[model samples]
Target: MKKRSMAVMAAFALAAAGCSGGSGGANPSSGGAKPADSAPAKTEAPAKQVTLSYALWDKNQVPAMEEIIKKFKEKQPNIDVKIELTPSGKEYWQKMETAAIGGTLPDVLWMNGPNIVKYASNGMLMAIGDQVKASGLDLKNYPESLVNLYTVGGKLYGIPKDFDTVGMWYNKKMFDEAGVKYPDGNWDWNAVVEAAKKLTNPGKGVWGIAADMNSQEAYYNTIIQAGGGVISDDKKKSGYDSPEAIAGLKFWTDLIHVHKVSPTLAQMTDTTPIKLFESGKVAMLWAGSWNAIEFAKNEFTKDKVDVAALPKQKQQGVVIHGLANVISAKTKNPKEAWTFVSFLGSKEAAEILAKTGTVIPAFNGTQTTWVKSTPQFNLQVYIDMLSYSKPYPVSKDTSKWNNLETEYFKKAWTGELKIEDAAKQVATKMNEFLAQEK
Candidate 1:
């Protein structure tokens, strides 16, 4: 239950020894010309078998990943891939760091926005921009924001796999009990506020909504909707001190402090927003596209819940974030590694992932399959938001400032500090970090 921003952890992993500064690397050497006239017999040397470790953190997606690996072997009969699963969060990053230090990091692995800059900057990742160009892979096949997210210093380090956007999920059962109509496209911030007021039933211990301090699902979406940018377009300045940004932060704090519709920060300490929605303790949950698979499979939610695009204020907004497949710079089999990464980025591999309904595939046309995979809810809301989706805010070393969000935001969530005051403090510290990121 760490915050979603932590989904992309700090880039403090030490750089590996001898990593190339750029995508440059030695090509596989081919056999030399046959000896002049001494040939008695010619025999093709046996193909060298290679075993590559493919690391990923999501156990739920392992089956699909293995299916992709299985398809990869048909084309690469001499190469074998071993699945390496790691529980996400700190443990996974720590293990990755240890492997990098030992020069044993997985040949192919998952990458995210926060760590791309760190790894690419330190030369821990292989630059695949050349391979992508050589293969004629159209960057347009995926969202441009995603491509830009994984690129650092004009070098592309990863290829997008899947993306998620924020949405409002409501329990139809609760809406009916509260006599409030279900949310829809016509809804706006005022509509939500009005409905939430009618939906709260303290006697039943159920609140109208969950206004947790989750930036991705809550504040980030609202901030953008309120015409506030999280960071300057250049990534060199913090936007938290703007009046628009303060208004956005106050929106949620007001829900907890003035509106009395959302659970208190203390009340939510043991249970998360998603959990409250899942257990029917809350009417609505602000969540991401990633929740589709979980909601489809959960007995309580599968039958009673549905989703709608987030209500807007000044603008339509939601943060779009995705994961990419990348290769380790020190991988012994760069050719094979690229082959696997390439396959993961292809439409076929995307179809396999889409069938699981776990995420919205980055491949252009494969999203429809994911939408149809689940009929219980309107998954199209996620895809619809894509047109206006804003890339999650990031920088060369997002971790440097990402950690500071919880530190400063918690005070406001707990009502220990004024929302504007807390936001200004965060902006001051975030600006200090932005200035140092050369």
Candidate 2:
């Protein structure tokens, strides 16, 4: 849900004290009584005071982060952490890239799946595998997919912070008004279609769903549910042109064009799908677990919304993505940065973040509080979906192909290009990019 960044091993070494012994007897020339042999008092050196810069995009999570920082301060009084909030993911990444070029990147920052490989391959991130091992931080404490997500070229560059998956969010009031059965795990694409048809009301200006062209929250999950994938497992080719992918694409496009049960691309562009759903203009929204806090706080939708597993297609599946905390390779306070990063990844930090309801903490066994944070909604759907979730697809230079996806998919969504043709074109271009990665 939140786009982010790696981990560092903190190594705290207490300054060892040295002892100097005096002669048992004083010098006879001084005429002083024999002085007993005594060692100088041992004193440990004070730890060096270090300051670390932590960058993140989500302002909503700042409170939780600050709370974590407060606890970290008590543990390491010498280390001072400052939070830099960028607010926008696009601007955040752009700034990170510029900072990387200038070697002024933050000591610690959030890293996402799409940018991890690019950053790690370019040596912009510190390889923390050895440090993590030396610190005795068990990688097994996190999901294997997430741990593997931050690992590049046999080296781990980050530690997972949190994970998210998609679910179908529906307005209970709308469902009740339409007298349609609420969706559940058993519902498939056909059931979704039938429900959408029954729920659409042109007079009241309410759409059955908001079929936004979001990769993670919308089409990606459907693509996987349809038994399709965006890229091959080997990362050597594209799967966009496959019939299954097309079917997945059609599921959204048809809702807009054939079924007339969703808003058009232009409408969604003007007002985001989340806003539409929040305003009660859309009956259902496919969104990520990250929306829980916002939805729970919204006045209009707070008590009227609930989530269910995304309707099944060929099989049950969802796209799983997460944020990791990583250290900049250029950081001046490498040890201090690692110390803070290590603390952030600890179960203590995870529990703190979980109770805040800001995110589903990646540390195993720490998500129950987060789920319970919003008791009215079935937040557990997100955690349950993890069992069958597919890791968000990515590769070296994912942004290049990602841009291409947006460019061509827009044409398909607007009906300027047919879904089949657009998908094939994307596949051809994506394959070219993949080949170049070799």
Candidate 3:
């Protein structure tokens, strides 16, 4: 599909980016004694109709997942399936938390890396080793980085659903107008800055970039470039105090406040950088491949918008995260619930998921066709990036720390706080967080 120039990306694409993902804690189903590995041990209870609720936040993919459930019904006509959507982003987390406290979480939940540790650590998540073994999901089949995200304390609590890596998304028409050649994977930070400067035409509302301030979006890449760890060896120290790390962050800070090539922090909060890019007000947005699905909307076909890996800093790396399917330890119907969870992790399910264009399925090789589902942009970057991808930072409180960075980052981005001061304070606060976590 050709990309759309000066065209608006479908509105949902922007919403998808802002929507934060989370899941609730779940206990084993009532009387759901952990079943034996061989066949699901039959229950002595009456064979009443069983309803399994699947909770997901992305409304866009709900339709596709529902289709899979329909197929599931063909196999087990007696089991009824229900679909529930948690409002996208933060609201979803709150809802999940409430469900967790109430012990009414859906039978199967979408699991993101950040909260898996928090939930699994609390013993709310069901152990999926038996399910994976039964479903024949050899942990070795998945990329180590992705599988590691949900594996804690030697227990694999989640089944890999899909994974995506970050990439640079650019507006093709803008590049042509600026007489700038398209960026290649080989481009460096200096090249990125130079390109952004040429792409700018503030008088006309076009800027070179929608500078991403999210650490998950930018700083993780920067940390790798700086050759510093996001956390120390003991996982109890902040790596932000290093000069290289500061320089890494300054790359974006300079682009906004100093170089004046992107919107200010306040501006970004109101109008997302990607929306600006899609609307032709900006030229580039660094986002994950999970987004490529929504960009499949009518406007972005045939080279109008496209993707490439981010310009290299001191290091060449990318951030990759996958959503997993985790069973709640609190589930009352483990035998029945495990069947659904196992089915979702099977190659058959991955194939269905791959067809939806919602995410890059985790069952390797199944993701090959996902990029082809989009016409507006080149999805090759995301595929290539996976080879060099690293896991997003993990912690018992990924929210507490990431939220801290997001809130304080605006200070540096808005020019209200100097970069050094901002980085220094961030380091201090991060260290303090590490201290408390310990």
CA RMSD, predictions in order: 9.7, 15.5, 10.2
Please give, for residues 137-167, the per-residue lDDT of candidate 2 as tens digits. Answer: 7766676677778888899998889888889
Lowest summed-lDDT stretch of 10 residues in model 3?
25-34
- How much is the lDDT of residue 319 in candidate 3? 65
| Candidate 1 residue lDDT tens string, 1-438 | 345223323334432111011111111011222212212121122267888888877766788888988987887787889999986544666677777555577999877776677777766799998888776666667766677677888899998888888789999999998789999866888898889889898888989998888877888888989999888889899999999889889999988898999999988888978789899999988987878888888889999999999988999877778888899999998877877787788777888889888778877667889999898889988878777777678777677677778888899999999999999999999999899888
User: How does candidate 1 score on lDDT?
Assistant: 0.78
Model 3, span 101-220: residue lDDT tens: 556777888878767766676566888776666555455445555566678888888877877677888888899999998988899888888899999998897889877787656767
lDDT of each: 0.78, 0.80, 0.69
What is the alpha-carbon lDDT of model 2 when measured against the actual structure?
0.80
TM-score of candidate 1 versus the correct structure, residues matched by position: 0.86
Residue 143 error for model 1, in Å? Answer: 2.3
Ranking by TM-score: 2, 1, 3
**TM-score, each model?**
0.86, 0.88, 0.85
Comparing candidate 1 with candidate 3, which one achieves the higher TM-score?
1
Give candidate 3's error at residue 206 in angstroms: 1.4
Poorest 10 consecutive residues by lDDT, candidate 2: 14-23
Best by TM-score: 2
Clashes of each: 0, 11, 27
